[model samples]
Target: MGILNVTPDSFSDGGRYTDVDAAIEHGMDLYRAGADIVDIGGESTRPGAARVDAATEVSRVVPVISGLAAAGVPMSIDTTRAAVASAALAAGASVINDVSGGLADPAMAGVARDAGCPWILMHWRGHSRDMAQLAVYRDVVAEVCTELLARVENATAGGVDPGQIILDPGLGFAKTAEHNWALSRRLDVLVDLGFPVLFGASLKTYLGRLLAGPDGTPRPVDRRADATLATSVLAVAAGAWGVRVHDVAATVDALAVWRATGSPRLAKP
Candidate 1:
């Protein structure tokens, strides 16, 4: 998976692909670079980012999705609005990457069920505005697992097929840097939740802090490829079903290497 933010305020690639033509071209490039799916988000979910209305979001991503779909690129609309998901699916996106996990929009599960499309429901407490406050948890991994399981049960009852739901841990959504790292270390717990886990830790601020340079500056997004690859390979090592990433070819290559060695890193003595 490749990240394609079509909003002007997305954290990393904001404003770079806001233009329809440029977004289309970037989507094509992702495909050419061996991306299995390109995740296009019209809303910026960066911490403390403000929300954009559904009309503007739909307008931003629908055409790009349509164009990408027509060109044979499988796309996933990274949105929380049922209306936007419906429109993107109508425009040819195959999956709904809802960062809100239906919390923000009650009709989201219905839309997924009605369409029979796989919905990637991420664990979200609230929107960017107040999510930080909701980050407090007794045991981060246990709480996240419980919450995700509840979501699965609720969605299943709401008519979404069990097989069509992918679970995301909501890495940087409401969690602090420590929370994110703790979640990463405990991905196995999430994978055991009876759903395919989607790991999305691409160029996150937590990672920047982790790989900060000696000069008191964090590594730039353009220079975080090594750390990104490490996180991706770690996700795969932890039995993740899939990893949503910005760079596809690198992850693909790493997976290939991983699989060649029986997908194992080393044997403990």
Candidate 2:
């Protein structure tokens, strides 16, 4: 999956493609580069960010969804609001990638159930504004797994078919650097939950911190593509069903090489 964030405050690549034309061109480019799906997000989920109104959120992504859909590229809307998800799907989004995992809105699960589209439910504690306060965990991996499973149950009970659902651990949503690392190290646990797992760790600050630049300062999120690619391939090796990313071309190329060669798709160290 290729990530296309239209919000001006996303931690990475914000303001780079807020225009509909530019965003659509970028989505098409991702399709050409080897992304199986392009995910469009109108809100910035960077920690402590303020929420955008549903109207503005819809405005940011509907046209992109429409253009991508018309171009025959699969598209997913990265939103937590039921209103935005419904609008985007009506406008031609095929998947609902909700980072909140049905916690923010009681109507989201029903919406997905009615639409019958593939729903990507991520493990989240609260909205971006207050999620950090909810990140405390006794066992980050086990707790995340359990919470995600509960979300799957909620979606199922709400009428979303078990087969049409996917799970995401939400690498940077509210996790500390160590928590993210632990989740990345044990992605196989998520895969064992009987649903497709989506890993969305592209260009996150955690990777930047891990792979500091030569100046001894943490690398910027925009400069973490190589590290992101490494994590993508590792996620695949750990049995992740898909990887969400900003630079789809690089990920696709790396995956192609792994698939073409006799090596494992994820080639974990």
Candidate 3:
């Protein structure tokens, strides 16, 4: 999967694709560069980012989604609003990647159920504005697993088909670097839950912080591609069903190497 953030403040690559034409071009570029799916998000979900009204978000993403869909690019609607999801689906989006996990909008599950498309329920404690404070957890992996399971149950009860549900551990949302690492190490736990796990660790802040300078300043987003590729290949080795990424070509190459090797381990013991 490739990420297409059509918002003005999405931590990285925000204003880069806000224009409808530009967003469509980028989505096409991602597809040409070997992306299986392009995740187009209208609102910025960065920490402390303010929310956009549903109408505004819908306007921002619909034209781009429509254009991409017209061009035969598979797309996923990255949103928390049911209205926006519905509009995007109408515009030809095939999947709904809800960061809120049906917690923010009660109408989301209904939209997914009605569409019968895949709904990605990311493990989220709250919205971006207050999610940092909600990162607290006694056992991060266990708590995330429990919460995601609850989301699955709730979504099913709300009419979404069990087979259409995809789980995302939500690497950066409401999670500290340590929490992200813990979840990465225990992805097996999530994989064993009988749901497809979507890993979205591409060019995120945690990778930047982990590859910081000697003075402890985090690396810039452009410099995080290498780290993203590492995480992408490792996630595949660890049994992730798919990885949402920004640099699809590099990851595709890495996965090619991983497949050619026929051994997941890059180093011999």
Candidate 4:
């Protein structure tokens, strides 16, 4: 999956694709670079970011999705609102990537069910504005897995087809750098939960912090693409079903190398 943030305040690549034409061109670039799917998000979910009204979100993503879909590029609607997902689907989006994991809106599950498209349920504790406060976790891995399972259960009960559901660990949503690393290392726990797992660590704050300078300034977002590729390769090697990334071509090349190495099985800890 390739990420296309069409908002003005996403942590990375914000304001770069807010224009419909630019967003569509970027989607085409991702598709031509080997992305299996291009995920277009309108609202910025970065911590403390103000919410974008549902109407604005729909307006931002639908045209781009429509353009991409018309060009034969597979697309996913990255949103929390059922209304936005419904609109995007009508515009030819075939998947719903909800970072809220059905917790934010009561109608999201119904949208997924009626659309009969894949739904990505990311592990989330709260809205981005206050999610950092909810990051408290004793055993991050075990807790995340358990919570994700509960989400899956609720989604299925809400009428979403079990086979159409996918799970994402939601790397930077509400997690600290430590928690993100811990979850990344133990992703097998989530993958073992009988659903496809999506790892989305592309250009996240944690990677920037990890690559911080001696003076402690975080690495810039553009500089994090190489680290993102490393995580993508590792995640795929560890059995992730997919990875959402900004640098699609780099990730594609990295995965190709890993596959050329016979796709060696990652060792158990």
Candidate 5:
């Protein structure tokens, strides 16, 4: 999967693809660079960001999705609102990547159930604006797994098929750097839940922090591609079904190398 943020305030790559033509071109570029699917999000889920209205989100994504769909690029709608997801699906999206894991909107499950497309349920405690306050966890790995299981249960109980569900440990949404690292270290536990796990640690704050300078200033977003690639390789080695990344070619190249080394099969738990 490749990340495409169409909003103006996303932590990274914001304002770069807000134009429909630019967004479509980038989506096609991602596909040509070896992304299986381009995950397009209209809202900014970065910490402390304000929410955009549903109509605005739909307007931002539908045109781009329609353009990409016409060009034969597979796409996923990265949204928590059922209305936005439905519009994107109607515009040619084949998957729903909800960060809130069906907790934000009561109608999201119904939308997923009716569409019968893959639904990505990310482990989330609250909306982005207040999520920083909800990052508390005694055992990060165990708690994330348990919370993801509950989300899976909720998805199934809401009439979505178990097979259609995918799990994502929401990496920077509400997690501190430690929490993110802990989850990454123990990702195999999340994969063991029997659902395909989607790891999305591309250009996140934690990666920037990990590469901080001696002055303690975090590395810039553009400078974190290597870190993102490292995480992608390690996540796949840990049995992640897919990785959401900004640099599709780099990740694809790294995974190809890993495959050539036969590390993927050997590294799986």
Candidate 6:
């Protein structure tokens, strides 16, 4: 999967693709660069960011989704609102990447159930604006797993097929750098839940902090591609189902190398 943010305030790559034409072009570029699917989000879920109204989100994503759909690029609607997801699906999106994990909106499960498309349920405690305060976790991995399982139960009970469900650990949202690293280190536990796990650590703040300079300033977003690539490779090695990334070509190249090496088994059998 490739990441494409159509909002002006996403932590990284924001404002760069807010224009409809530019967003479409970038979506196509991701597809051409070997992305199996392009995940397009209209809202900025970066920490402390304000939420955009549903109408605005729908307006931002639908046109780009329509354009990309017309050009034959497979796309996923990265939203928590059922209305926005429905509009994008009508505009040609085939998947729902809900960071809220169907918790934000009561209607989201119904939308996913009706669409019968893949529904990615990310582990989220709250919206971006208040998420920082909600990051408190005694055992990050265990709590995340329990929370994700509850989400899975909700999704299944809400009539979405189990086969269509995908799980994401919600790396930066409401998670400290230590929490993010802990989840990454034990990603296979999430994978073992019998659902396809989607790892999305592309240009996240945790990686920036991990690569901070001497002055303690975090590494710039653009400079974190190598770290992102390393995470992608390692995630796949750890049995993650897919990785959502911004530098699609680099990740694709690295994975190709991993594949060429007979795709050696790294996860415990």
What RMSD does each model have against the real structure? 1.8, 1.8, 1.9, 0.8, 1.2, 1.1
**Residue-wise C-alpha lDDT for candidate 1, range 1-269, written one tens digit per residue:** 89999999887889999889999999999899888899999999988999889999999999999999999999899999999999999999999999988888989999999999989989999989889899898899999988888888889999999999999999988899899999998888888777888999998988888888999698887887788899998888887888888888888998888888885633222
lDDT, candidate 3, 1-269, per-residue tens: 99999998888898999888989999999999999999999999998999999999999999999999999999999999999999999999999999999999989999999999999999998988899999999999899999999999999999989999999999989999999999988888888899988998988899999999999999999999999998888888877889999988888999999989897533311
- Alpha carbon RMSD to native, model 5: 1.2
Error of 6 at 217 (Å): 1.4
What local lDDT does model 5 show for residue 143? 90
Residue-level lDDT of model 4, residues 13-123, one tens digit each, is 889999999999999999999999999999999989999799999999999999999999999999999999999999999999999999999799999999889999999
Q: TM-score of each candidate? A: 0.96, 0.95, 0.97, 0.98, 0.98, 0.98
The C-alpha lDDT values of all candidates are: 0.90, 0.90, 0.92, 0.93, 0.94, 0.94
Question: What tens-digit string does per-residue lDDT give for candidate 2 at 94-122?
Answer: 89999999888889998899999999999
Point out the higher-scoring one by TM-score: 2 or 6.
Answer: 6
Relative to the unseen true structure, what is the C-alpha lDDT of residue 235 in candidate 1, on a scale of 0 to 100?
A: 87
Predicted structure 4: lDDT: 0.93
- In model 3, the Cα lDDT at residue 57 comes to 97
lDDT of 5 by residue, 140-202 (tens): 899988988998888889999999999999998789999999889889888889999999999
**Runs off by more than 4 Å, candidate 1:** 265-269
Say which prediction, candidate 3 or candidate 5, comes out ahead on lDDT: 5
Per-residue lDDT over 1-269 for candidate 6, one digit per residue giving the tens place of the 0 to 100 score: 99999999988887999999999999999999999999999999989889999999999999999999999999999999999999999999999999999999979999999999999999999998899999999999899999999998999899999999999999988999999999999998888889999999999888899999999999999899999999999999998999999999999999999989987647563
Where in model 4 is the C-alpha error above 4 Å? none
Error of 6 at 175 (Å): 0.8
Shift of residue 196 alpha carbon in model 3, Å: 0.5
Question: Which residue pairs clash within candidate 6?
Answer: none
Between 4 and 6, whose lDDT is larger? 6
* Superposed Cα RMSD, model 4: 0.8
Instruction: Report the poorest 10 consecutive residues by lDDT, candidate 4.
Output: 260-269
